[model samples]
Target chain A: MPIRNTDHAWGSINKAFHWILALLIIGMGFLGWYMTWLPNAPGKIKIYALHKSIGLTILALVLLRILWRQFDRRPSELPMPHWQAVAARGVHIALYGVMLLMPLSGWLFNSAGNFPLQWFGLFHVPSLTDGENPALKAIAGITHLILFWVLLVAFVLHAGGALKHHFIDRDSTLRRMLPWGTRAEKSSPPPAMTATHSTPNSSSPTEVKS
Target chain B: MKTVLLFVLASGFCASAGARDWSTDAAASKLGFSGTYQNEKFEGQFKKFDAVISFDAADLSKAKFDVTVDVASVNTANEERDGSLKDKEFFDFAKFPKAHFVTSAFRKAADGSIEADGTLTVRDKSKPVTLKVKFSEAGDKATLDADTKLNRLDFDVGSGDWKDTSIIGADVLVHAHLSLTAKAG
Candidate 1:
């Protein structure tokens, strides 16, 4: 597989970003949920700080992913029903939107409260607001809190769609995006697709290792 | 300004004799404080504070100041921090609505600056404090600018998590800038 994306599969760079963000988002969800429940203590503050730092990291990585996407072509959409394809596209868009927006809302909430922002405690990030703005602070904080639910729903839908393609329809939707190598044809195709096709595109018989 | 002119004239006429009383222009004065929050520096001001001033350049023994600051008026530019600051673990504004400062004596420093010895009362604790003062008397208006450093822990201002000074420093720099008008004798 190539380092850059191909017409049929994702690049290593894209896959790395996808999985890394996925893991971080999952971790952040737990941290965010747990920290709010903790009693007001020094330990809670530390955890909150860590959450901010990791959230900022995710924000930076999301930007890089979007920027890379500008230069990198996406693999063609797998063949599916028109409604499923549309739903999949909507889910993907919403996921990307949440990924980009979550950090910004957090930053606004921080800035609106005129709170300190440090990138992993290395340096400060400039505040967006001038001073203590009660209205903006409340609004931004609510937005930040609410977006977590949006992220969770979008993630479930996205993952569910991929699984559906893998199990029910049995296509290359999931395999093309998988981290490991598989010919996407030999082992990944539905039994019906394999039985009908004799001429496969490119490559000799590479062993399927999924 | 008319009062200021009269007070200035009075002070000038009696400069050789005694200390003159002055009143602060609340609109033109500020009581500010600053400290670090993590790696970032945060600044705040006490919006409601009143100071009574009596001073003479030559009469150090007679110079005195009494100030009352509303603890609940503390604004750190951060609303969450400001809210947190008023809680029981911090200023406990519900219990102690006011902080007080009173200067008992004044002395000229070796560097020809002035220092006022005083006691600052915050929450339930009182501590001896000294304010480094730069008292500049303009022709018609006198300005009283003073600065002092305070340890919040000294007064039990920050109790629970705030004791971790590494995250939020215990040392707070308090500054006062009062636009003063002399009161006629």
Candidate 2:
């Protein structure tokens, strides 16, 4: 099916952002679980440092995606059963909301717990809380755990939906977001590839708006 | 006759002389104690703390001892509270890691308890304080119990004002029990 100008599929750049961020979030979730059983022994410091690094990166990339989404138009929605469309819309919005809240709550949790956040030994991210209050600390701890579960569930639903589209629907819905797929399927390629592939004759003047 | 009188007096003085009061045994003796600090709505014990105490009963006239406690070893179980105590605004473990107390004077009290006056140094602040100490001797071992109250504001522990006292108490109590054995001759 041809990509529509409106109510259409994701363009290459948008698809790239979604896939890359999804991959990073998945890696982060697994890393978080693995770090918990680290025995608080040798190399624990390094593990924690690595976790903080990834957490900060997720914060940055997620923020960047949000800004990009605001400026660039989203691909048109797929035509489907009314209920399926509603479910899809609700889940996508919830996915974005929880995605934003998870990292933010994680930051507050670490800050309140008084863990110095250093980005790869560069510098410390100053603490957000002052003197310790058991009640406040407990609340922050609970919030952190809840957000983690929410993020996990949202991710599974998001991935399962994508996979369902790929296998059951046999449509370009999943292919459109795969990193290796065609321009309409994948997001914009890396700057290096685009620069290398650029040629005066290959330019589609109308496609330059992106 | 005069020589005999001198000998008699010397023997009497020697008879009344007491044994040495303090020992320098680095091992087999330990000082254990508990200290509590409160912040706004959080209060916890400083668990698993040991101090070095050396003193003797016979040398009460000129007794002296030094005490040192590990700051990092404090355990409140709550990570946030423990972490705050380690920060620069509090214990400042990076700069002044260990708190110390050194005895400077001891005076016999009419009530039989001894008033051991000393300087307690915590986080670079040294404050003169007196500990009420009771001692019990048994064979080759001696037990000492001391209790003291400290005003943290005097040491700039918290802010100068008591406004923060709602969370962190203004006064901290330090209690110690030291059991020591006589060193071998």
Off by over 4 Å in 2: A1-9, A181-210, B1-65, B68-185
Q: Write the per-residue lDDT of candidate 1 for residues B23-125, one digit (tens) a residue.
A: 9999999999998878567898999998989887768887989999998998877656777888899888889999999998899999999999999999889
User: Model 1 misses residue A175 by how many Å?
Assistant: 3.0
| DockQ by candidate, in order | 0.62, 0.06
Q: Write the per-residue lDDT of candidate 2 for residues B1-185, one digit (tens) a residue.
A: 99999999986664445343444233543343333322222234443344444455656755666777777776554584566667766778898778888888887889877889999888989999999887777877777778787887777665433225534566766666666666554
Q: Write the per-residue lDDT of candidate 2 for residues A1-210, one digit (tens) a residue.
A: 333222234555665567677777888788878988875332554576677777777778778877877766554333334565556666677667766776677666766665556676676665567734456667776876787887777667767776776587554556655555355433422442343344232222211111
- Please provide TM-scores, in order, for all candidate models, with all chains considered together: 0.87, 0.51
Where is model 1 more than 4 Å wrong at Cα? A183-186, A190-210, B1-18
**TM-score winner among the candidates?**
1
For model 2 the TM-score comes to 0.51
Note the residue pairs that clash in candidate 1: none
